[model samples]
Target: MQCAYCTEKAVMNTPPRCKNHFVELFEKTAHETIKEFNLIQEGQTLCVAASGGKDSLALLEVLHTQYPVEALCVDEGIAGYRDTSIRDLQAYCTEKSIPLRIVSFADLGSKSLDELNPTHPCSTCGVLRRKALLQYSTKYDLIATGHNLDDEAQTILMNILRNQRQLLSRIGPKTPAQQGIAARIKPFYLIPEKEIRAYCLLKQITTNFSECPNVVKSFRWRVGEELNELERKQPGTKKNIVTAFLNKHYVREEHKRCEQHFCRRCGMPASNELCRACTLITIGS
Candidate 1:
């Protein structure tokens, strides 16, 4: 099939575009999303939460083109998984001359995720990872994550299914700063996971395609599989899910307000006296 805008053969089915056109559309969408959300302002420091995965590397490549950005990675200390990814991240940051910072669970005085032996590995790792990001990214104005449309959709669905109104409310392109925590932005909020992989390939960004061995044990894995099946049956399902969530007035209002307390142990933003990370660390210890 011919590309919708050019004579070249189409490589993407959605909107029917060739390689060049598809890459162009993918990048343009990210820029548009940033502008639409006002995610970054002039002279503001931006840090991308690089995991050395396709999505994060793709985001770093795109955003670095127009904005001065740095890379921050969390080493969960999972053997063989995080190590390989960190190597790729280091190489990319070095080649681009972007400063890179890494924080590990060990740095937090807690054991590595693999050694933690938590009952819920993914959930445990997530809490620690967020803490690591926030703790180390205090110098940045905003922290950009590589959360693509699929990840956002999965999160929305998970929150809805679990009736987590507070979390559901916060799912969006950007999250405002609360207390001492840095604001977070998702430039790929509208970009699809497949498109991100394609962008990485087209741009020849260094990425580790390996999946975390613990992913299959998580609730998100099940939801993602179900969501993918639904999307296959009905295209645009993921986008619709996010759009509908964003259109809810209650969600928008809720996002504007948050009740935050300081973690007594770490002095970080938390709903309770102890942040989730501190609590997890206590439990693991």
Candidate 2:
């Protein structure tokens, strides 16, 4: 398994950190997606959803070093774990001089994610996080997340298995901005999860190791494990899967239907009359 760019070293090793090579590889790939999808402009304010995990940390680092970016973290009000992750994230941001913002579920008047009525806390947390990110990011023109190829592949397969056609249509490198909100972008859409983890390790970048405290056992975990196994068996399987879906299965026009519109309830760009965040609150209310 030779390196994708350099054929000398095996792809799995701690790759050499040549600034030129690194910038060239990332910028070229990112520029291609940016051009193809019109993801961002030169002067756009980019907000990165930094989860304090390796992937998001790497995302923040890359964007801060390469482009204009602000690191945003959402705290789900999981008392013990959330504070620890925030402390570390703050330290990293302060050390690097990266602008940072913290939004808590408390600030949004939501209780702990574990207290949500939904069986899967992830559903509530995700909706709340997105809402907070959108609310806090007034100046940014784009919101970038650290979703890598492995995650994308796992999610695509998960959606397809569950017959989630609409969700499948929404899975890609680019997605519509919420009405009056910055568009979403995934610059690392082609990069594999393992590669991101490896890059973090090689760079010795510090990140939070805590998993989501309230995450229940779910099918997505099994799918993630399966994807990891497949990656081990066939290098680049995740990238290949995402590329295949983006090139062959993904329908741009069909996904355009997923475009964000103003929610009647919250006035936020939503897929429905009430955004997911408002709906969750209403259910809990």
Candidate 3:
């Protein structure tokens, strides 16, 4: 097959790119997104939420090459899942000389996964993980997550379905959740998942294939399956969904309308006296 950009042979088909071109394509697009979104400045410190998965592994590679980055891993204490992921992250960070900070579910409170009580484990686990990541991310100038196009698209659809206009407003690269929190950015926001996996394979980056065992329990995952089918039928549906939201002039205005105040309990940003994490964590197990 011939390359789409040039006459060099194509190494990937679906999108149609040559091996070198494919790599270049991925790198160039990420850089472009960073520039367009102003995701990272030249001298700022960056902390990545690396989960030892393909998305984050690929994200760390690109960011490490471009800036000084410290990797932070949140150990949610799930047996055989988060433990193995943190181990993978630890090894990779050590090998690459990147600083890795591990904050655990147990460290914050209890050490064992069995100790937590929640009606929805997967949903609760996600909240816990985000709280942990945000808590640890306090020291950095910016927090970069590995969320890609597909992830963003799925989230947009879910929020729209639920009429979560407030959450939908916070979909861009530099939207900080609340005061005192560095902005959250996703450099791969425009990159497709397929390309990330291909880049990981091409670069030979070591990453886990096994997803979190409890992922099937997520409402988001179910939505993702349906979204994938929609994407298969209608190419660029994901991009279109996100693009439409991002293009709205009221997005930033609506995001500012989030009205942040500190959580009286844990002191993180909260809409009420207690943050969602603090409120949820306090439930009887």
Candidate 4:
């Protein structure tokens, strides 16, 4: 195969990148995405949500080369999975001398995710984890995630299909800052997951490959499976879908209406009277 941007022979397949130019293309795309969205700016500290997975690891490695980044890990208290990944994340950050912080389910509430109702564990876990990330990120400029093209596309389709149009309003490379909330950004928003994996492979960045034990119980698993099949059949379908949404002005206008307000209970940013995390944590506690 030939490189997508050049005529030289290509070494990577998914959105094709040549060995000689793949790394350049990968890092260039990452930088361009950051600049395009102003994910990181002068005098602003960046805290990456490092999960020790390939995407997170790759994101940390790439960003660290250009900026001083602190890492944060959320331990959902999955007995085997989170413990193992935490070790990997810890080792990577320690070896690189980057500051790291870890918060757990126990720290947030009395019940660990394993103890929660098995039905829709991710729904509950997501609220908690997101809240933990955002809550801890209260001091930082923006909370960056390794959300690549594939992840973004699946979420867009899932939200639309679920009639959660409100969720689509927040879809973009970077979310504008709101009261009592740190802005969230996705530097890899336009990058393909395959490219990230390949970048990790090429850079020899070691990351945990273990799947989260709770993944099978999540709605994302089903949506991801279907989207993967669609992507395989129609290359660029994912990027096109997401790019179209990103370029649409009306969607963003509606998203802006999904405003933030302080939770009456915990005084953190919340859409409802009680922040979802605090609500779930209150139940779990």
The TM-score that candidate 2 achieves is 0.85
Best by TM-score: 1
The sequence of per-residue lDDT tens digits that candidate 2 reaches over residues 205-283 is: 7765557655546667778888888888987777787878888644575576654466787677667888879887777
lDDT of every predicted structure (CA atoms): 0.88, 0.74, 0.81, 0.83
Q: List all candidate RMSDs to the true structure.
A: 1.2, 3.3, 1.8, 2.0
Supply the TM-score for candidate 3: 0.94
Candidate 4 stretches with Cα past 4 Å from truth are 1-9, 14-16
TM-score of each: 0.97, 0.85, 0.94, 0.93
lDDT of 4 by residue, 192-251 (tens): 887888888888877767688888877788998988898889877889999998888967
- List the candidate numbers ranked by TM-score, top first: 1, 3, 4, 2
Clashing pairs in 3: 106-110, 106-111
lDDT of 1 at 194: 89
In candidate 1, stretches whose alpha carbon ends up further than 4 angstroms from where it belongs are none
Of candidates 3 and 1, the better by lDDT: 1
lDDT of 3: 0.81
RMSD of 3: 1.8
Candidate 3 per-residue lDDT, tens place, 165-258, comes to 7676557666764656767899999988989999989988877778887788778899999988999999889889889878887778877777
Clash number by candidate, in order: 0, 0, 2, 1
